[model samples]
Target: MDPPPPPQPPQFSLIPPSQIPPPQQNSNPNIQPDSIPNWDQNPNLTHYLDLSVPKKRRRGRSQRNSALFRSPLTLNASSNNDLSSYAITSSSSSAAVAPPVSFSSIRNPPPSLTQSSSAYDFSDEIIMINKEPKTEAMIALSAGFPADSLSEEEIETGVIPVIGGIEQDKTPTEPSKPGVIIIGAGLAGLAAARQLMRFGFKVTVLEGRKRAGGRVYTKKMEVGSRVGAVAELGGSVLTGTLGNPLGIVARQLGDVLHKVRDKCPLYSVDGKPVNPDMDMKVESAFNRLLDKASRLRQLMGEVSVDVSLGAALETFRQVYKDAVNDEEMKLFNWHLANLEYANAGLISHLSLAFWDQDDPYDMGGDHCFLPGGNGKLVQALAENVPIFYEKTVHTIRYGSDGVQVIAGSQVFEGDMALCTVPLGVLKKGSIKFIPELPQRKLDGIRRLGFGLLNKLCHSCWWSPVDCFSGR
Candidate 1:
């Protein structure tokens, strides 16, 4: 027996990026009871989340070499606006040149995170992480490779030879603060940087992508000479606006928030709308499934064996067969498929045993979507921080002293580091770690899986429909 085809992952409806479904268009003025809306060749229909294929892994030296290189770079911080850093590359042992590279720019900045005049202030109390807790000022622990790994010859000649006037006087000032280095400028990384900055810690963010936002992306439409429509290519909705941090930020930014709900108009293949009776049946099945999923315990005092939703759904079918007819079941299946979007994976991967173990957050409010995509939130949070674009981190070395990050051709050192790279990237092993990670951490990294969700945006169109004709 071919091991009964692997359980298919749950499927989610491909909603247009804006969650704005085009209304059915009909030529007939007087619509018939069975008249279905024609969606064939609809130009306005957009495919929001296209999970047709798996995501491709990042390529280049980071994926291949995965080696660590420590180079001393020059930082010109005299003028905040003209602050730029450069890395030197040597051709032959004879000579090389250091190209001027603009690391980051500080434009008209946002309000400070706190009452402090600037975001780079040090407090009396020292904050340390992941080592013997010490209370003092700044400190830098050396983070070089194992002594045995480096040859004596290589060690003696490791200093990057400067071909230009790039060297600056190593003037000793008040020992600088122990800074933080954040890899990946995605939402999570940006959020961490923002919080750390608010706490008066220096932070430098390295982003592989040109833009700041990672998963949160927005695409703008343009007409012949002017901009037209706008839609989100990633992260469309905020599940609950109330008590949601992102929602709060959106509201503060003066972005229009549209309230959305679970209810949506349903039509059959021929455009015939599902009758109220059938709709009720679909809703009942969905509710029952939710109830069953919530009941994590088995009969009496035994623990329930966790199974995929597909498996438990079969049990539901036996119990509620009478209430759900074939037609209704089809509609229910359509609704159930939407779970894929929420979970970002197949139902088989979801565990019924600990589904809701992490105290889910639901404030009983309408789902909201920011008219201006989530990229705005990313931009807002990335203010005042130095972010190096197109810096793909290849390896990280952390120890009692601090952390050193090597990305592309640049090297960054900091007091601590926050690795916000997606699990997919981590699983690909694109990055190497010095001294290696613990077995348990490695196991967790391998065990957990990441999913892919893509979005496509198109023009928006709308038409009206009436579902009461059958009644």
Candidate 2:
């Protein structure tokens, strides 16, 4: 029989906790380091990007497998608040003395490895790591894994390994808490930050746009003699009231939300009211088309093929040629336009398989909307959260230690990072990943479609002699 395989080093998981300590506003009145820290004075900050450790080819299957091990520490953040940047101090018994390394200063390296700053700054928080010997406990502890998560042998040894180039902490009493970096300051990002902060995480939000409200925009309009009025330009309505996350938040924030009125008056091209019988016929035709499309979609699913709703509608129109005339067909198309309007996409691009997907609670029928618009939702979530705006993140690099985000010349580092960018932006391939994403994920990104919906809000003056005069 083959001999038992050699033992492998304990794998370190760098999964960031949901929360850390809430980030307190920077209390240092004299110092303002909101943007990238001034690294010119301390060139050592640039060394953080260096991979000086030489690579070696491993011989056996065991060594080869170990070589392939990659840490899951890739916390990617966008242009914004991610986490607290702290100082990192390292020391060795063999080397008589060495300077402490700052996590923010990792981008630079000093000319001499032996030289280190003699003065210690306790005010600058340090990530404490014990330096003894490489063991399962050490790797687990360094990555912030709980003691119970380890095995019996790992618990017994309690050895701590020192990563190369990075020195161990002189004091191990106070271990630095993990932090999370959130990209995007929209509703989801801000909401995530709020929850994570409550969980005791130091959270930072980065927004590429100047404002926090991602796609939720509210526009104000004032016409000739009319007073001010607001219109929802994005994400207007709440699908339901019961168990609706947005509705719950609106209630907590004391915002007014009313159920939308479903009634709409139909008129002819000449501005005359359409006959009630013609309206009923148009409505009936639309309903029939929807039913036909559903059946066609079911049949297409059996063949493992997907088609657009527009394609299905055309097929329905072809089959029910005598049901409606050209004018009636146009009216039916107008009613069905709501589907495209709601999705901000055309039927030609919408997937028939998932186009009708919606929450079952919504079927109960009352759709609600905020009079002030969805921007109120954004404001409620972004409260107290620090957001860095206008910083376009270009790249994210993660490893066993932490994640580093690069936007322009600035670098934001944290234990974990969350990306809340729009699917449209991600599909553009503007931001690049370090190791590259898997093929299936990239394929999904391509398969998924993004749509654009335009809104034009304006006020018009009506005179008695105008079209209304005919009524």
User: Of the candidates shown, which would achieve the greatest TM-score relative to the real structure?
Assistant: 1
Against the reference, the lDDT scores of all candidates come to 0.48, 0.50
Where model 2 places Cα greater than 4 Å from the true spot, the runs are 1-177, 220-227, 296-301, 304-308, 343-352, 357-365, 459-471
What residue runs in model 1 are displaced by over 4 Å at the alpha carbon?
1-176, 296-302, 322-325, 460-471
Which candidate has the highest lDDT of all? Answer: 2
RMSD to the true structure for each prediction, in A, is 23.5, 26.2
In model 1, state the lDDT of residue 79: 39
| Tens-digit lDDT track of model 2 for 124-207 | 111112232232232322222221123332323222112223332232233244778888887788877765665467787888
For residue 295, give model 1's deviation from the true position in Å: 4.0
